[model samples]
Target chain A: EAGVTQFPSHSVIEKGQTVTLRCDPISGHDNLYWYRRVMGKEIKFLLHFVKESKQDESGMPNNRFLAERTGGTYSTLKVQPAELEDSGVYFCASSQGHWTGELFFGEGSRLTVL
Target chain B: GIQVEQSPPDLILQEGANSTLRCNFSDSVNNLQWFHQNPWGQLINLFYIPSGTKQNGRLSATTVATERYSLLYISSSQTTDSGVYFCAVGDSNAGKSTFGDGTTLTVKP
Candidate 1:
């Protein structure tokens, strides 16, 4: 089975620019999640989607960051007017279930905001 | 929110040696997972062990949920094992999983 896949494995943009990262989860998976890892920091959750509706989004950093999952198959994280601190690796994960299932992660999208 | 901490923040080992990485969570969790972040920045699932013990090849993991801690054992380590090992845990009531700072393991050949 195909695992989670992300696009634009690496992105470089100037501060204040906009960049969008996309993730395609495995087929039939209902739970999708987004996480980010800043340099020298732990990976942190960003948001979660159960099908097309957002289940939780408490981890979103600020108003400049937005995430959407339309039709429940793929997700997009957009950072508008990105700041230097936003440079990091963004990961997307999916699981068959919410509570007890294993999570499969994608090859992270590395964003470098300078 | 649950907090996950991984120990021996950094480790270096000679190939063929063995090692153990530890993770401690602040609260009871319904999901606990170990992942290896390779040099290419891919998070590969190593184990999904919330309780009890599980072994896969030379790698084994044990989670004492009552004590809120987990241990991952790597036997006969190889250079390919060099990477960052992260432990993530999720509370039953939360939809998201909290991750540890990760243990950076370097296995020298």
Candidate 2:
């Protein structure tokens, strides 16, 4: 079975620019999650989607960052007017259940805001 | 939010050596996972051991949910085992897993 897959393995953009990262979870997986890891920091959760509806978004850094899962299959994280601190690796994960299953992560999208 | 802490922050082991990595959390958790982030930046799940003990090949993990701590043991380490191991925990009430800084392991061949 295909695991979680992310697009634009690496992205480089100027400060204040916008970048969108995409993730396609495994088939039939209803639970999707987003996490970020800045240089020298631990991986932190960003948000979660159960099917097309957002389950939780308490981890979103600020108003400039937005995430959406349209049809419950894939997800997109967009950072508008990105700041220097936005440079890091963004990971997407999926599981069969909320807190009862193992999570599978993607290769991660590395964003470099110069 | 729950706090997950892993130690010792870093470790170096010989190919034939064995080592244990530890993780401590601040509160009760219904989910606990151990992951290894390889040099290529892929976070691979090793175990979803919320409690009890499990072994896979030369790697094993034990979680003491009552004590809010977990331990991962790597036996007969290999050069390919070099990577960052992370511990993540989540409570049913929060619905999100909190990760630790991770234990960076370097296995010398």
Candidate 3:
């Protein structure tokens, strides 16, 4: 089975620009997650989706960031008016289910907001 | 939210040496996992050892739930082991995993 796949291995945008990162989870996986790691910081969870519905979004950084999973498949994270601090690696992962802790992660999308 | 701590923020070792990295949690009930982040920034799941001991070749891990700590042992470490190792814990009731700052291991050949 294919692992989780992320689009645009790297991206660069102006501070006020908008960027969207996409993730394709493994086939038949019902749980999807979004996480990010800023420079010199630990990777932090952004949100989670079970099918097309959000299971938890407690870790979303702010209102400028939005994530969506449509048709219970691919997911997209959009950052509006990106800040310099938003430059980092955004990773997406998936698991067979929520109860399982074994996560398969993607290569990550490196976002550089200048 | 529970606090997760990893020891030895950074480590440098010879290729043939063995090393043990530690992770401690302030509180936990269920589920603990370890992952290695490569230079390319891919997070690879190494183990899901919430309790007891598990071994996979040269990499082994043990978690003592009673003591709220976990240990990752890399025997005969290789240059391929150079990366950041992270520990994450998930609360049984909460279902979300809390991640540690991670230990950066550099293995020189």
Candidate 4:
């Protein structure tokens, strides 16, 4: 079985530009998560999805950030009008279930907004 | 939301040595795990121990949920073990995880 895989290992965009990061979770995994780690900061959760429906999005930083998982498969996170502060490593993870399961993380997408 | 605090923020040791890393959560019912973020930045699952103790080779983790704390033990550590160890506690009710800043361990050859 393959582990979680993220696209465009790294991305660079100018301020006010938009960028989308993609994540392909492990097969048959229903729980997908989006998390970010800004420079010198601990990793923080952004949102979660169970199948195609969002289970929790309490950690989303602002309205400019949007995440979606279509057909309960791959997921994408779009950061619009990216700010310099948006520069960080975006990680996607998957688990077999929403509770009491180990998480499998991807290599992470490093976003640099200048 | 739960708060997680990892102790010793950093550690450096020689190969073949043993060490213990600690994590304290504000509160937890179940669902806790230890992850090792390798040099390439992949978060690898080390243990999913929410209670009691579980051992796997040179790595073992013990979670005393009642005391709201956990311990990760590395025995006869190797260079490959150098990485950041994170402890995440999930709210059994919400299924959301709260991760600590992490304990960074550097092993010397």
Q: Please report the candidate that would top DockQ against the real structure.
A: 1
Query: lDDT of model 2 at residue B98?
Result: 89
* Model 1: per-residue Cα lDDT at residue A88: 96
Off by over 4 Å in 3: none
TM-scores vs. true structure, each candidate: 0.97, 0.97, 0.96, 0.95
The superposed Cα distance between candidate 2 and the true structure at residue A3, in angstroms, equals 0.5
Per-residue lDDT of model 2, residues B35-65, tens digit only:
9999999999999999999999999999999
Steric clash pairs (candidate 2): none
Q: Mind giving the per-residue lDDT tens digits that candidate 2 earns over A16-97?
A: 9999999999998898999999985899999989999998998999999999998888999999989999999999998886
Query: Candidate 4's residue-wise lDDT over B28-62, tens digit each?
Result: 65788899989987788899888999999999999
RMSD of each: 0.9, 1.1, 1.2, 1.3
lDDT by candidate, in order shown: 0.94, 0.93, 0.91, 0.90
CAPRI verdict (incorrect, acceptable, medium, high) for model 3: medium
Residue-level error in angstroms, candidate 4, position B13: 1.1
Poorly placed runs, candidate 4 (over 4 Å): none
| Best-to-worst TM-score order | 1, 2, 3, 4
Q: Evaluated with lDDT, which candidate comes out highest?
A: 1
Q: Model 4, B39: alpha-carbon shift in Å?
A: 1.8
